[model samples]
Target: MSRFLFVVPPLAGHVNAAGAVARALLARGHDVAWVGPESALRRLLGDGVTVYPTGMRPYGGQRDRGARALRSLWEGFVLPFARFTRPAVARAVAAYRPDVVAVDQHALAGALVATAAGLPWASLAPQSMELTEPLRALPRVDAWIRANLAAMWCEAGLPAEEYVDPRFSPHLVLGFTTPALTGPAPFPPHYALVGPALDHDRPDEPDFPWAALDPRRRLVLVTMGTLAEDVARDFYPRLVAALAPLGDRVQAVIAAAPHTVPDPPPHVLVVPRAPVLELLPRVGAVICHAGLNTVCEALAYGIPLVMAPIKHDQPVTAAQVVAAGAGVRVRFGRSRPAELRAALTEVLDSPPYRAAAARVAESFAAAGGAAAAAIHLERLATS
Candidate 1:
């Protein structure tokens, strides 16, 4: 049997996606081991997989821009942590001696460890990292390059000369985006579009207050994902204020997150978390942060959206929604109550948004991400 080690950052989205791949690998009679933070241990355990805890929780904070987040990751996590864990990783490699490693793109420790061990490794991209023409044309090109260079130098102890080589490419680069959305890039031979792997076996069916939900009023589900956990803090109040005008005509369900539940607006139902798929079929529209998993989840249900993209790859992901005519993007600085209300109204009122969402839903159905990824990994392991 092929022995594989999958390393992931502590982030839920990363762990969730990696877990899907691990499960697929295990089902194919391969031995799978995950080396990362204890946060992922529970889920991996539930899947009957082995875990090697790294005692490192990745820094999870929202930056104003994607570039800033990347910079922070390099400085805060990679530089210090990779050096600290080098010995531990070395020992793990010697003990387990995995044949291959699949790791999240954000985590450099995995890359370093795998390279040190001389094992084949795959870099997994859970968000949009593919450099686009517009991004490349941005005026602050020099500043961006400087930051990236500085990051690389600090994290990997690499000078400019080292990065020029094609040896930097991982054995495989698995992209988690629908081929329909991302146009082709001239990637390496091993590059594979694995699409969004949202294989969450939702345990603890949270008692969704369906009886409390107003059947007469049109429902709208709002969320900003688990990382941006406390929705009640700042954004939730503003959203409630904006959507309050809809009143009895529209029933808003805000997953305010369990720990910090906000006092609900008159027309809104505040819940910790809802079975997104089960809830989406009854809802007219969704308002969310432009998280990749959330975006894909909404598309899977063919739910039109008003995307309030906060940070990271969100702006770009939101742009895709607008470009596809599937949803409206409520930009960072411009998400006032009135603007949100208008955007939500537009998505609900128009047939085009619904039609666009339906088209993408069809595309996703055709792609069959989970099944495809399972088949691919099975072949890779067996071969």
Candidate 2:
């Protein structure tokens, strides 16, 4: 069995998907470990895996949408965080000496360190931002991104001419999505679209009141994922109002801090956090911020969505959901209660939406999830 180290970002959404594959590696009698923010990994992964510590700074400032969000992420967070974590990543690589390094796309330091050390590595692309090429229409912006990547490559003291795109490893790239939802987007032959790496046994999932879920009424899940906390506070109230009227036929599980939706109606169950993976099968539809992990997880369970994208790749994922006929897209913040109500009702009551979700789920299962990803990684490690 080979030693595999996962170099992940501090972000919950990215880490969660990688965790699934890491566990898969473990299940096959391989050694699996993580290198990221110590506290966050501990919180998300528990004591099952070894974690190498790294510094983390909360991503401050406004989480804008579209081009602004994309640009701001690279400039404000990704580059700076990469620079900050570079030394620590190098140290982790030196000490662990793994056969293969699985690097998250946003965690540039991992790619840099692994490349510098001449170690085998694979790309862990949990987001659709680059895979779908949302910025292709804007040539200058895309060029600017390329320039930044090239500059970062040089900064790692690697010869500029020999630089490979760190976001995509030449050996393998594990995409946490499928063409069923992404439409006609083309990917390279080396890119493995392994659908959602659903970790059914993830640690540290928040407690939920299972008894409160009414089997008679259709269940809907409302969540903004981990990063959308700033907007979720205000958004929760609107969600409460929108779903309240549907109580007779629908019971909703709103995954928010109790204080965010303190006075939810009797029919609504509001929790600070939820074991969403376990809850998806029981849900008829999902209302979410379109975080890739949540979106893929819902679709994997054949649950339609009412997506209100907040920032980053969410808008793209939400667009894909709509194009796939599996969900409705309502504007985040700009959407009023009535709009939310209609979107939610549409996904819940529409037979076509459920059928589309089930079809996507079929595609996901065929795409091979954690098991396929682990096989690819194992091959890359010993090839």
Candidate 3:
């Protein structure tokens, strides 16, 4: 059995995706370990797993508006994160000496260190951003990103010429979405489109009042994802008000920050968190921030969406959803209650949206999920 080390960022979504693959590897009789923030990994993967803590700073906040968003992503989070984690990851590698490393896409330092050490590594892309042409469309931005990555590699004493995109592994790249959701894209032979690695055995089921939900009314889930709680505060009330008109005909479940909305309308259920996987099966449509994980989860259950993209890869993911005929997109900051209600109504009332979502669901199932990801990692380790 080969020993595998997973290097991930502190982000919950990235950790969850990597954890799914780690569980699959362990089930296959391979020894697995993690190199990341210890507390966060323990919370996501449970206490049984071994972890080498490389505590790094959390991703800082970014401005939600203007052309500066991408700049802020690099300056505020990406570059700083890599710089901070590089030494820690290098230390972890020396101490653990695993056969192969599974590197989260955002954690570029892991890949750089592993490559420098001549160990096989795979890139875990929780989001499908690398598969899309967002950067290619903007050549200058793409060049700027590449330059920064090259500089980072050079500073770490690794060959800068070897760097193409740190997010794409030289050995393997595991994308967590299928072409059905992302549409067709030209990817390299090493890239594998393994669908979202959703953990089916997670024990933390939220105490949702499932019995209280009316079966007669169509259910809808509204969430701005984990990172957007502060940015989406003002938007939540508008969303609640918009969906309130449906009253008994439609029931809305809004997941926001704790105490963000004290008194929601009668038709809306405001909670700090919702067991989204458990709730998706009963819901007809989802209104979300177009986060890759949330979008994939909703689509996995064949539920259509109303996407409001705030920043980062959200706009790209939302575009894919709209292009696939599975959802509608709206501006997050400017969208009014009337617009949100109209978009939600379209997703819920239209049969085509449901059909498209079902089609994506089939593709996701075919992509083989955590099992497929494990197989690829195993191949990398043994090859």
Instruction: Please tell me which predicted candidate would have the highest lDDT against the true structure.
Output: 2
On lDDT, who's better, 2 or 3?
Answer: 2
Weakest ten-residue segment in model 3 by summed lDDT: 62-71
Clash pairs of candidate 1? none
**lDDT agreement with native, every candidate:** 0.68, 0.87, 0.85
TM-score of each: 0.84, 0.96, 0.95
lDDT of 2 at 374: 97
5-64, model 3: which lDDT tens digit per residue? 898887778887888898899999999988877887787777888888877565768755
Give per-candidate clash totals.
Answer: 0, 0, 0
Q: In model 3, which residue pairs have backbone atoms overlapping below 3 Å?
A: none
Quote the lDDT for 231 in model 1: 31
Runs off by more than 4 Å, candidate 2: 137-140
lDDT for each residue of candidate 1 in 51-97, tens digit (9 for 90 to 100): 67677644544443456654554566545555555556556667788
lDDT tens digits, residue span 1-383, model 2: 99999998877788888988998899999998888889889888887679988878766455666777778888888878888888989998889999999999989888898999999899998987777774776576678878998998999999997999888898788998999998877788888999999887778787778988889999888888876676677788888888879889999888776877858999998887888988887888899989889999999999999999987778888999999999999988778889999998898888999999999999999988998999999999888
Q: Give the TM-score of candidate 2.
A: 0.96
